[model samples]
Target: MEKLLTIKDVQEHLQLGRNRVYQLIKIDSFPKIKIGNTYRIPKREYLEWIQNNIGKTVFL
Candidate 1:
């Protein structure tokens, strides 16, 4: 099992606004786990996703 991150964590880590993080989450391939009314991002998968998407433009 890996660490799970909150949306706030992602926002702070990426220096992005809450709206931007939410926009990324709306993307089909973004890694996320929805539990009840909240969302958790798998730490490893999030890192991998960033690496994988480098040099690509993401649009919400």
Candidate 2:
């Protein structure tokens, strides 16, 4: 089975603030799983997200 990551784990891995992560989720750019009031992201999905965003700048 794939590893599941908590919000905190993702924040640390990406070196981003909680609010930033939440914001990303709001924009649907970040992959997230909502379980009750908590959020989780699959390791594979996270890796895929990174790969998909590679070399893509926010400001064009």
Candidate 3:
């Protein structure tokens, strides 16, 4: 199975606040899975998102 990352992992990796990570989760394009009350992000897609958004605005 592919490795899944929690919101906390994403926050730590990106050095972002918890709320910011949660905000990203709300974006349809952002890769995520909702299990019960928790959210999981795919590590690979998260990395790709970082790559694709480098030097670009994350929100319009």
Question: How many residue pairs of model 2 clash at the backbone?
Answer: 0
**lDDT score, residue 3, model 1?**
97
The lDDT values for all models are: 0.95, 0.82, 0.88
How well is each residue in 1-60 modelled by candidate 1, as lDDT tens digits? 799999999999989999999999999899999999999999999999999999998877
Give each model a TM-score. Answer: 0.94, 0.84, 0.89
Q: In model 1, which residue pairs have backbone atoms overlapping below 3 Å? A: none
Ranking by TM-score: 1, 3, 2
The model with the greatest TM-score is 1
RMSD of each: 0.7, 2.3, 1.3
lDDT of prediction 2: 0.82
Off by over 4 Å in 3: none
Residue ranges of candidate 2 with Cα displaced over 4 Å = 58-60
Per-residue lDDT of candidate 2, residues 1-60 (tens digit)? 889898789889989899877777675677788999988899999899889899986421
Top lDDT hit: 1
